[model samples]
Target: MSQVRVQPTADAIRAGARAIRRRNVEIVNAAGLGHIGGDLSAADILATLYLGVLNVDPDQPDDPERDRYIQSKGHASGVLYTTLAAAGFIPDSLLDTYMADGSPLNGHPDRNKVPGVETNTGPLGHGLPVAVGTAIAAKLDASPRRTYVLCGDGELQEGSNWEAIMAAGHRGLDNLVAIIDRNGLQQGARTEATNALDPLDAKFAAFGWAVRTVDGHDIDELLATFRAAPFERGRPSCVIAHTRKGRGVSFIEDRVEWHHKVPSAEQTAQAIEELSE
Candidate 1:
């Protein structure tokens, strides 16, 4: 099958991003709970991947040679689900069932039920290894498909990601790209107050990754970064997306308390209004 040419215009990309954030907010508001902070933080990156970069078809989600997208920071499943729905990977109505009993859309992403989700990830640091394995398989099969994993900055505290990093570099898996959502804040508090990953870019470089740091909310920057593939001939690439938790909403941005806080009805309305502006 020929790869679908992704000539995502800036307006379309922005629309996708808005749709993701709006849907995420709606889901969390309906469920009366969710990791909205992280969800909002990663919305732009998710939009860039699903709508701008990935060669995936919502109609043929199981195509073997299609690019893979894994959400390593699964707690933000709200964002992933909304992104999938916005990108047509799943019915938009299913978002209403989020966190409901027996619904496939749970608090954490499940690969079994979600068509576009590449792996079941709720535990931190699991996505990189899965992505690395997928990248290796693509290489072995001589397929041009690439693997992209979105990992949270706090999730990097887990040692497994480092191991995966080493393996990807050692095997020269240039098909793999890891995008870190560096929103600074974690569940309990700021990442710096807990475990600092200040030298994150250098760490990836030391592990032999070609690193690119960009503002996660900028559509132009994200599009450019995603398109500039294979920064190094024999090395996997890592994009440190510096983002703010609760990015689009002013009151919530960078607020650690919003990590798992469900916005009140009034706050939700305000947030939606703010995003629409």
Candidate 2:
């Protein structure tokens, strides 16, 4: 059965976001490879979900009735791993082994190796389709579980996501909630410079989704938006979380080059200090 969604205080959510950012820096510094930009941008969203929105038990991650969360922007797996550790799914010590040889914590999350991870995802545009399938299954089983997927705005250029979007809206999978990390910047440059997803809200609305836009980093807004999923009676829900790339770190914030760039010792120190504040 679906657990009740916890409405967290702003202070609590901000604290969680800080912890995730601090740990994310540490993880990337230790691993020497990560999608740091996206990781930072998506940290708050991940924090809000694991800390308050998702109905998941670390000890019972595979429970059939538990709410499902899929990270569509899997390149930013560091954020996901850090959030899982924060939520007690695994020891914080495991974070030290991230991206190391023989470590289960690879660049992309592996469901078989990581507790609380719903699936293995790294390629763009894959998570939403899988989430749609799972949502459909839950509906067929008459389960109370809700499916949540987090995708990057740049990844929306993929055809697969649109196909899944069409299918989800057509099938009226109200149990599904898709959150887009609309950080604007992709790996190379602004998403609009590469492949424009302008009128993103209208695009999804036309697909028969109940669309809503929110400050992705705002904990209070995230909690409220997620708590009110399936915004319409018979259509799927889509949340366009407007976020800044490399959020919370002054040097990296909104810089496209920082996408997978590793921070130097000085940069890492500064990032830690800023997030700690």
lDDT to native, each model: 0.91, 0.94
lDDT of 2 by residue, 192-212 (tens): 999999899999999999999
Give residue 49's lDDT in candidate 1 (0 to 100). Answer: 85
- TM-scores of the models, in the order given: 0.98, 0.97
Off by over 4 Å in 2: 1-7
Q: Per-residue alpha-carbon lDDT of model 1 for 105-195, expressed as tens digits?
A: 9898887998988889999999889999999999999999999999999999999999999999899889999999999999988888899
C-alpha lDDT of candidate 1 relative to the true structure = 0.91
Judged by lDDT against the true structure, how good is candidate 2? 0.94
- Regions of model 1 farther than 4 Å from truth: 2-6
